[model samples]
Target: MNKLKNKVMLRGALSMLLLAGLGFHSFAQKKNWQNLDLQKDSVFGIDTEKAYEELLKGKKSAPVLVGVLDGGVDINHEDLKRVIWVNKKEKAGNGKDDDKNGYIDDVNGWNFLGSAKGSVSHEALELTRILRRDKAKFENVTAAIVKPADSAAFNQYLKAKIDFEKQTDEAKNAVANIGGLKTVLDSMVKKMGKEKPELADFQNFKAESSIEDRLKRIMVSQLQNSTFEAFYSSQIVKGLEHYQDQLDYNLNPDFDPRPELVGDNYADSQQRNYGSNDVKGPDASHGTHVSGIIAADRTNTIGIQGVADNVMIMGVRAVPDGDERDKDVANSIRYAVANGAKVLNMSFGKGYSWDKKAVDEAVKYAVSKDVLLVQAAGNDNKNLDVEKSFPDRRYEDGGVASSYIVVGASGPNDDKTLKADFSNYGKTTVDVFAPGVQIYSTVPDNKYEAYNGTSMASPVVAGLAALIRSYYPKLTAVQVKEIILKSVVKVNHNVDIEMEEGIAPKSVPFADLCITGGIVNAYEALKLAATYK
Candidate 1:
């Protein structure tokens, strides 16, 4: 591990120097994005020139299967049809479990969400569960109040208490702040004689405004300026409401909504008889986008081609619109492993994971079966070692299962700010970075949209993993992970970027974000994987 880390660091340093020689910025300069196709020709994405060279060599592997444990995938998508994984054990539509694998007719994959078509907020379920089961323990208690004796329950209650307090504080601050901003904006809009004033209105106001008015106008102007929609329906407002739910009524640790969905407890992984063949769950967009990125058909002149030529996407609707449940994730991993999936791509995460042990066990099961799992580090842009995120192979005891790799999001430029503003990263938590910003891929309903997140980054690595496993079947899961880590090109320079705090922006060395301080290059990764044997 030490040797691999050192080689990656040294190679990264050299790559940075080489890029610098070619005028890649210490902080990459902004490029005009108008009419730009990042997938076809971009400095941050696949080096098309190099990729084409590899294509000529005919070195790509046979079709490989990657289990996508997110929302349901659009299996019928034109670009994705050839690559969607089919469960041969169970017939497609006989209304029976043909393979008798406990799940009833899981021809594609199982949906953990009770209804075959609905959205579940990660915050809503997890927070609601925690608040209900544990709030009583912390009721009106002083700091010195001793927790009751059951070690596991007591510990869980204590954690819930702390999380609840923090969330409550955050919700209060946000509601107050947003409320104040809304007041000022409301007055300004009334003054301008329009509810949704455009830029021209602001300019007109600025021309006639007095000095005091100008100061107020400047403050409002700064608040209104952002690529996102206005403050009312913004991400921050949503985040605040989410926190409020967690604080007030959603933190009960024992709350289980799976009963509402399937009338069975999800914690019982062995109870898999529930759920149906309706693979495209409530929101198919996430799964469809991911599948398109991994194995969408190429040269057909339809939607974009995925990273790999021959790949099969197995849709497992375990993740919902919000955070995923640990039980569902654990079962999904086992199901994929048992179903012959060599690689699993997890693009969802949560701040709370009550049954982490269950997830750890499932990860071990996959590793034992020689399966490699690629997970999204998250999108909070935090140093995760200081915080907690879910779907990790590492146990809380500080040990990691061999087959898991966590990915962070990198941008199209070679600068520090080039890291996606929303990417969650940590030197200890994340394995590598990949092109994640404005990634165009397949969405539900046979559509294509450019979505950005660590979600996109994970699928790219998963594709690379599938390719490596397909060609180099002799390599162990651990060895495959090491090859990917060792082959990355690192950058070490101070670049402007956002931080988790949402305070004033600051600059930091790009290398500090993840264990592999480089982006995943498929061409380089395949070369390294071949050499590993």
Candidate 2:
């Protein structure tokens, strides 16, 4: 058993090395491909610009409302401002709930992560919360003492606690290692009397001693594979800071930011109207990017065009910097459905769900209202058929929700590396793949940036669904879902995709990664929508 475990560990380490090498290549490729014309790009993009120019030309399309349930959205973003959803029934800045829909002053949309005073940016991870909430009940208690009804809860608590401890240790170690590397890089840069030293500079610099010579050689070797600007960007520093914050806040069981911010009974799913109206809460980058992907103004030449033209992006802020609560997710879904949103985009997800029943019921309600749901398949790079992801398409009664669509990320290249190394896939669960890696979209404060994730992939599909609903207003949510699934551009060849960080790349049929075995094509989907009865 020990030998087997050691072999598995070695394989895992090799997998990580392979992934790192591939990721470096992917980054360079993204920089080169960003300049391609949107209309003619065949590198995994859905060909939305071509669809508009050809199939959708001179066709009247109804406005479709797409709910973006995420951290928050900058409703006043320049390119996105005109396309934001406005609740006409509710009066803005009034103390009363004018619309009588239980929420007060939800003009732009609702902020379920906020309260009267402020909004929460970070909170405990679900595992940390579970361990904290159940510690007193199960601490030091043996399995023999657990009642038959409490056995499941006890086991859950044990698993959460173990995961929490392991993750916390790993996060701390990563932060320390990154800090050390940054320090060394900073010191080397200072010696060269340059703010951003190049690899050539390090290679030519004479060392004062053997120790200095060894350090210089090491730094030169590391810098050879990456550009100075790309390797030492403010984003990397910010990412390190975020990981530190995760250890200080998310993994700390006693750290509860909700009381000082949201001030809601998080355990109570019945309390519907507790949050504030700050739609553009603390951080709007994630939600704003997602919103722009679905419905940025197509006519505006200032920024990139969105996938769908006639779309009103309804901002439903529910996700925080950490894992979103099941209560907030449920409320966000119901709010979107009740407010005439035809398509809901959920770009955030976590491993554990505290109130899955509530969320499941909310999904059922959305299906009843004929609202289509689009969710990210996650970024764990694991097969969902073996491991579970939250906010999945499975219903509580062991049925599948027809209105739900789960998306996986795909890269620009259509060859063996077409599947994103970070995207999670499942032959049974994932519906389709879309262009997600290095997707350029709107960020907060009218800026644009490229981000990669299944998070980006989900909005791409949501935007396509909105387009289908806009042009074919007669089609129901289920029909639109079917059309998108059936109309994908199938990749018939087998492709190599990473199953995990430390595992060997597996060459599986591209179809086996998703139900449709194809990447989404907006042009094809629009054509199919027109033909569907």
Candidate 3:
């Protein structure tokens, strides 16, 4: 789904292969561009170092508990071990409910996708589930003969069918294109007789046919951004595997895994007694990266400095490879809130919702406890005013939720590309922007890499919120959200935006993309936060 940014991610790989581009920034100099100050670095960053140096010089901060609601987190990473949240009241691997919270152990956090045996790594998309359930009733029905009583169901079924077909087709074509490109890369390596070819080795060579020309384009693009060896080894393999997983599991109707894997009653929305205490599930890359961005130990001075210093990261493993169940999301929110989390970073979203009411009640529950909720604005590049991005701040009944902030992705440069081309935006939907493009953070296995998407952006804001709450312990969640929104570095110039892919880009005021009309700045926010107290 576009919410996960997987579709755009695949397209970006293919598009890069098709283009012949040039490098702008060298890898050695871009260690942490996202944390730099805009006035000093000529980029739109949060000015984290400035906040720490100029404002918070020798002040002591109270510890704040923040939750990351995503796939899972590697709490044992080098830079994360000391900062990871630990349930001191419960003992680890006790084989009994130590905290009496219905979950055994309850050490790190809960994993709703786990069972007594193993955990679920992959599942079908929400659209695929819709098609599978409604195919029997609406597959043969015509639009002309549809009754008003079943109008909503029929329309939903038809929309799901169209989207499912289009996504599957895109995945199939991408697989074929990537396969052909791999063949071209291998043949070039053999013909050139070089372990790592240079730009001149392929760009200056004369093409014999269309396939050769395609290979030249691919080589030139790869050589511009990185060494041909790195691109060939990393992106190509990742692209093929990502699309293949979509076909085999995400878009496949017969690939349901909840029955055998989760062992929970699929029909029960209120059943919260399932799941295990395995916080670090099969895939912890996304969650681990987000955790590092939020509160990775700054005192360790090893991998990277997280935005907030005195905050503990609690891992709530609710999201998976595909769409997360609404029950899991609701339970995750309640569990985190009940465990004394002052802020929750929700970095996952979906285009369709199976049960929104359950999720709405959870958000309401969080707000009632004065916990701030930070969410990603999605990566579809579509105007959120007209698009359907599920799990937004808007409740199912009426008004939007309080103490909630929606973040859009911002680039390093404050130019025509200031807004990430893939970030979803709206004049009122998106609350603020944060540095997300090429954001360097920690991944699994004690490693780090740069990842793009609003997923990365959400954690940046969450980290900032945690930073504010740490210093001003008496501030409410709504006050933190207001301070962040009011302290953004506003842009007064006209900027370009592409609402949809393959469409002509439109130039609008920078303020039109979001309500704040600016990107998040920690230095300014902290300066303003002091006055609120």
Best by lDDT: 3
- Local error of candidate 3 at residue 388 (angstroms): 0.5
TM-score of each: 0.78, 0.90, 0.95
User: Which ranges in model 1 have alpha carbons more than 4 Å from their true place?
Assistant: 1-42, 46-49, 115-127, 138-156, 165-257, 266-270, 396-398, 497-504
Measured with C-alpha atoms, the lDDT of residue 141 in candidate 1 is 58
Ranking by lDDT: 3, 2, 1
lDDT of 3 by residue, 399-508 (tens): 98999999999888778888887888999899999988877888888999777789989999999999999999899999999999999999888777864445678988
- Tens digits of lDDT, candidate 1, 141-172: 54455554645555555675676667556556
lDDT of each: 0.67, 0.80, 0.85
Output the lDDT of residue 520, model 1. Answer: 76
Question: Candidate 1, after superposition: displacement of residue 298 in Å?
Answer: 1.6
Model 3 weakest 10-residue run by lDDT: 20-29
For model 3 the local lDDT of residue 180 reads 77
Model 2, 449-512: lDDT tens per residue? Answer: 7777788888989999999999999999999999999988899888887654456888999999
